[model samples]
Structure formats: C-alpha cells, structure tokens
Target chain A: MNVTTVFINALAAVCLVFALIKDTTKTKQALKIAIISFFRIFPTVLAIIIIIGLLSGFVPESQISKIVGENAGFRGVLTVAFLGAILHIPSLISFPLAASLLEKGASITSVAVFITTLTMIGMVTLPLEIRILGKKLALLRNGLSFIIAIIIGLIIGVIL
Target chain B: MKKMSKEKQKKGLVKDMLFLGIILAIAIILLLIFPEKKELVISSSKGFFMEMILILPAVMILMGLFAVFVPNDVIVKYLGRSSGIKGIFLAILMGAFPTGPLYVAFPIAAALLKKGARISNIIAFLSAWACIKIPQELVELQFLGLKFMITRLLLTILFVIVMGIVIEQIVLLSEKTTKHEQTS
Candidate 1:
C-alpha cells in the first residue's frame, strides 16, 4: 500500500483497537456502523472507479487539459464550480475522483473549485437548509460560498 | 430520521446500481470496439479500486467510532456556551470531529441558534461540518496528496471564518433595519 493508504489505515486500526479496549459493546456498535457506511458508500465508490477508468482510458490527455487544464481559464473554472454545486456526490468519493481528474490533466483551479462547491453549496439540500436555517441564512451562505469557492480556486491555481 | 434516511438509501442504491450497470455495459461495448483500450481501463480501474479498498474501510471505522462516542448533545451543549473567536474555533473543531452528513447538522445548528449561539459561530459550525470533516479530510489527503489537501484545508478554514463573520454582519444589519422601521 502507498504511504497515505498505510497511514490512514493504521490510524483507523489504532483508533479501533483503543475503542475496543475501552468498551467491547461500543466498539461492536462502531463496527456495525462502519459496515453500514461501507455499504452505503460502496455504490458511489464503484461508480467513481468506473468513471475514473473511462475518464483515463477514453478521454485523451490533450482533450482534458484543453478544457480544464492550466490554460482553460476562468470560464472553465466557473463551469466546474456550477457542476459541483449541482452534483451531489459524497465528498469522500469526490477526492479520488478529483485526484483522477488532476492526474488526467485538469487544472488545479477547476478541481479545487469543484471539490469546494461540491462540499459547500449542496444544491440538492438547499431546501432542507432553508427550512432549518431560514431562507436568508441559507441563501446567503450558499451564495457567498459559491463566490469564495471560485476565489479559493483561483488563489490555489495561482499559488500551486 | 433513521428510517427516512434508510429509505433514501434504498432508493439511492437502486439508482446507483442502475447507473453502474449502464456504465459497465458501455465500458464493455467500448472495449469490444477498441480492444487496445481494455488494458488501460482495467489497470486504471484496478489501481483506484485497490487504493479505495485499502483506505475506505479505515475511514469508515473512524467515522463510526466518532459517531458512537461523540453524541450530538455534547456538541449542542458546547456550542451553546461559546462565542467570539474562541467560539468560531470551537465550532470548527466540533464540526470537524462529527460523523454525520451536513443535513444532520442543520437541525443542530438551528437548535444552537435557539439556544443563543452567535450567528458567526453557527455559520462557522455548519460550514466546517459540511467540508472540514475528519474522515473526509483523510480521504482527501490520501487521494489529492498532502499539499493539495493541506492547502485547500487552510483556504477553506480562512474563507469559512470570513464567510461566517460576514453573514453575521449582514443578518445583524437586516435585523437592525427591521427593528428601526418597527420603532419609527
């Protein structure tokens, strides 16, 4: 396994062992929860795997870089930000997908914008947010987040 | 809540499986037409699949442990008591540790509001909960590398804090305007 994978897995294993040592019943419950989440997240993981496969296999590097690469400019970044807001993929799966996109020649700006908006905006859950946090707070948060996501993307693009 | 989400999970599962099936079918067809790409596709998918398999369970276990140990009430109680810069930091800290999805945080934020948590802190809490999640960040670090993950994390922290303070000001201004009109 890669260093990142090894480190993360070790962290989890250590935490699990500690939890188990503290209380067997709670640890069992945690494990059950883990299994459920594993299943819950499995489909998206599989879908991302397939999409990454197709993306790397089918889309030419030149085509990818041409559209979302360093030269794709502000419009490309905005397009991705909008899509991120609209799409409702789990943020965890989005990382792998983002990594693949980066590997496939997507610009750092677009990828950063995509992940930020995907996590922050939540177009799909807007109504629920409105219902809970009031129309004003929810709208303001989402709108302002969209702007900052773009700004953050640009800054990252510049810095990195 | 559990039952409703369970139902949603079932519906989502069916939709995703259907989606996956279609994609797999398309992949098969493409591979048949252009056999040369099959090797590329298989290797790419296999590499990502293995990487995910290694790390995802661990991430999930950590999340599960946090969910079990850190009850929502504890968060509500702690956030209800904090304010100012300290409060914003606490909000983010509490948010990053929580295991549930963003929607699950909405009601808690609302409760925090009713309990008189500052608007800035509540906004910070929600935003942090949405993005800076512990398990989620680990996945980002694993996939996007330490530099990408850390840079984005830092940027997000800075912006979320600014957003929280700005929203609080706007909300306060609006409330003040309404109160002035009422008094006049």
Candidate 2:
C-alpha cells in the first residue's frame, strides 16, 4: 500500500480503539449518526459521479482540447469558466480531468478557470440550494460565483 | 438516565441491524451484476479503495468533533451581516485552512445559516476555501510552478470577495422586493 493508504489505515485503527474504550452509548450514537448521514448523502453523490463518468466517456478529449486551446483565446477562457460553473463538479474528479485536458492541449488558463469555477460555482446544485436556503441567498451566491469565475479566468489568462 | 440508556441501546441495536442488512443487500446485488472474478476484484479495488482513502474514517471523526465544539452562534454572529467585510475576510481565512471533506462543510454551513450567518458570505467562504486551500496550493506550486500557483490563488481570492459582495446585494434587493409586495 502507498503511504497515504497506510496513514489512513493507522488513523482508522486509532479511532476504532478510541470508540471501543469510550462510553458504549456514545459509541453507538456516533455509529448511528455516521450511517444515517452516509446513506442520506449517498444517492446525490452517486448520481453526480455517474453523470461525470458518462461525460468523460462520451465527450472526446480532443474536442475539449480544441475548444480550450491557446488559439481559442478570450472566448475559450470564458467558455471553459462557464462550463465549469454549470458542471459544479467536485475537486476529486476535476483534478484528474484537468490533468487529462492539459495533456490533450487545453490552455492553462482554460483549465485553471474550469477547475476554479467547477468548485466555486454550482448551476446543477442551485435548485437544491434554493430549497434548503432561500431563493434570495441561492441566487446571490451563484450570481457572484459566476461573475468571479470569469474574473479569475481573465486574470489567469493574463498572468499564465 | 437508566431508562434513557436502555432505550438508546435498543434503538442502537435496531439501527445496526438495518445498516448491516442494507450493506448486505448492496453487496449481493453487486455480486449478481458483476461476477466475482479476478478482474472484478481489481476494478473494485481501484475504485472503492481510492475513494475510501480520501474519505478516511479519521477525517469523519475529526469532523464530528468539530461539530460538537464549534458553536453556531459564534459563526453567525462574527460572520453574520453586522460584521461586514471583516466577517467576510475572516470567513475566507477560515476556508483557506483545510479541514475535512466537502460533506463535513455542509453541516457546519447549515448550522451557521440556522444561527443567522448570511448565506452569501457562507457560500463565499465554502467555495473559496474548499477550492483553493493553502495546503493544497503549496502542493500545486511544487508541481505546477510558483507563478501559476500564485496567479490562481490571487484570482480565486478576488473572485470570492466579489462574489460575496454581489450575493449580499442580490439578497438585499430580493428582501426589499418581498417587503414591497407584502405592503401592496
């Protein structure tokens, strides 16, 4: 196993021991809470992962590269940032995707903007956000995220 | 306390049984769908193990501890509307300090909102911090060049600040409209 794996395993073992020695009641409570929380969030996580996987499968990396290449210029950066906002992908997936896009000739600016916006902005999660928080708050958050994403793209474009 | 303890124990037992049953069901379904061959084993390891490592149980335990210690009132009062730019800046700072996974952030954010933390600022804090942590940036700088890392970092901070301000305005406007409509 890798260092990360070994570290994580050791951490888990420590926690497990702590749980065992702690109050039996608190241990049970913690387990219940963890299980409930995991199941509640699993469906949403699963759906997003599947959708991203499908996009990776269907969309030719070459096309993504062409549209976001150096020659694509200002429009390319904007397009990438906008796409990233819409996708609202998590970083775990976005990092590898960015790496692959770079390999396929995508501009650094485009990749940077896309990654920034993907995490910072959220189109797909907007509706759910509105429901959980109020519409006013949701709209404000998303609107600002969109605008800032563009700014980030431009700055990255200019600098790197 | 004794009665509560017995009830809790009973509840715990039931919940544990349910959790085990669900896991078993999922395992059986997966087994049926993808036969347990060497290739299947390899694929499962590649996917599940990677995810598990990232979502380590220790991280979850830390998150649980965080939830119990950090009061919602503190987040809302300091990071709430009355604090203004200072609050937003603090929020951004907090975000920059890497914590656990995104899931942990959700509960903390929700609690802050319930306690009156402004939504726009919370969003700004979460998005910015989650996206561009200082620790992560340090790693990126090593691999992706210092210039590239700094540029991305500065740009992300700028975007986060602007987004926070704009979102605040939108919320204020929406609140005004609702009040106007109610009067009408």
Which candidate number maximizes DockQ? 1
Query: Mind giving the per-residue lDDT tens digits that candidate 2 earns over B55-97?
Result: 5344444334333333445555556554577777788866665
Question: What C-alpha lDDT values do all the predictions have?
Answer: 0.91, 0.59
TM of chain B vs. native, candidate 1: 0.93
Model 2 alpha-carbon miss at residue B121, Å = 3.3
Local accuracy of candidate 1 as per-residue lDDT tens digits, B37-104: 98999999999999889998999999999999888999999999998789999999999997877899
lDDT of 2 at A35: 57
Overall local distance difference test of candidate 2: 0.59
DockQ agreement of candidate 1 with the native complex: 0.66
User: What pairs collide in candidate 1?
Assistant: none
Cα-based lDDT at residue B111, candidate 1: 92
Worst 10 residues of 2 chain A by lDDT: A47-56
Cα deviation at A89, candidate 1, in Å, is 0.7
